[model samples]
Target: MRLLSMITLALAFSPFAISQDPTTQSKIADATQDVVPSETSTQPLDFWMQKKLDYSTAILRGLAFSDFDLIETNANQMRMLNKIEGFVRNRNPEYRGHVHAFERVTDEVIRQAKQENIDGVTLAYHQLTVSCVRCHQSLREAE
Candidate 1:
């Protein structure tokens, strides 16, 4: 009897039981479509590359608007990405040097962003972009 009552209560509160409205179902489907996939579902290299692009874009946006909070968030993300396996593992000395250079510049960017030093951040950002281009060029040549 208790189990039956519990089932009855659940059914009573369930959306499908309350209404089979097409609009409600459509709304739920649309909301689910906006959900981001789990990190595990994405290819590691692709995921990190996309993150770098996204964080870089966010940093630019933050700089334009003097949004230190946004800059800090993205810069921190970039720092974390530097330590990931995709970035750090199995790298040759030259590749590793490039990675280290990128990290050093990124650290400077983070520090400048935290200090709200726009000019320092701008310089560091340019250096960071150069590091990215060099690293990517080397990677392409290696392939």
Candidate 2:
């Protein structure tokens, strides 16, 4: 009930208005369709897990696949990390430990990425995975 109430309040405060504008409405609808969970996704917990997975995949592509240089790569990942941090903070206050762990990792990753330290980026990626696992475990337990 508390979760449902929070969701309602968040929706109420969201900047994106339900638009009569067809183009804007279509864009929102498309984004919603793009994010629809697979049938194997079980609950809200699984939904968030999938989101984290998707972020990780995007980060990997930005790191490995993109032609962007190291600074650009790290900068993009840093922005992504910040976005994930904000999302988790708003949606999962109970997972503070996991959030803090990822924050530290992201900070170090950004610092090291700036310094051109390949190993630091690698270690941060590993830590990111661990942080996700820790939170997912906690979320599953809560369910």
Candidate 3:
């Protein structure tokens, strides 16, 4: 607890930790602004799971930024991301490969988005999103 508090305090006081690079910040901000809202639902798992895929794709496309920001960010997005990651990490390879692909494509998409290659980013994001939906659809069918 003491070590954790000291580390947190140190991070808070560090200039390098406090301020993000302007260009990277701007790209992330712009990407975050682009996520479309998910449809409302009473089913918690389905709602969050579907939205997680959407958010993941948006981040990949550079249309949606990380949930670390204040503006246009989903309140529960980080939780959803963690949940998806946990699910993916524990699942069998056949079920988890899509998550790995998502991580790769989203990383590429974000890079493209920062480079201002909008079309390329969009294509990658679209492919990743489609994969997520397909995977979930398969799960649903299996059940």
> Considering every candidate listed, which one attains the maximal TM-score?
1
Q: Model 3, 31-103: lDDT tens per residue?
A: 3333222233654445446666565543543354432232123322322243334443455555566666655
Model 3 lDDT, full chain set: 0.48
Residue 53, model 1, lDDT: 88
Clashing pairs in 1: none
Off by over 4 Å in 1: 1-44, 86-88
TM-score of each: 0.67, 0.49, 0.48
List of clashing residue pairs for candidate 3:
31-63, 31-64, 31-65, 32-65
Which tens-of-lDDT digit does each residue in 44-121 have in candidate 1? 446557878888998999889989867766775676555443333547877888878888998999899889999999
**lDDT string, candidate 2, 1-143, tens digits:** 45444543553344542432566445434444333333333565456445556656655665574322443333333434344445544556667666667777766666666665666666777787787678778878978
lDDT of 1: 0.69
C-alpha lDDT values of all predictions: 0.69, 0.54, 0.48
TM-score-based ranking: 1, 2, 3
Lowest lDDT sum, 10 consecutive residues, model 1, at: 29-38
Sort every candidate by lDDT, greatest first. Answer: 1, 2, 3
Best by lDDT: 1
Stretches off by above 4 angstroms in model 2 are: 1-51, 62-94
The 10-residue segment of model 2 with minimum total lDDT is 66-75
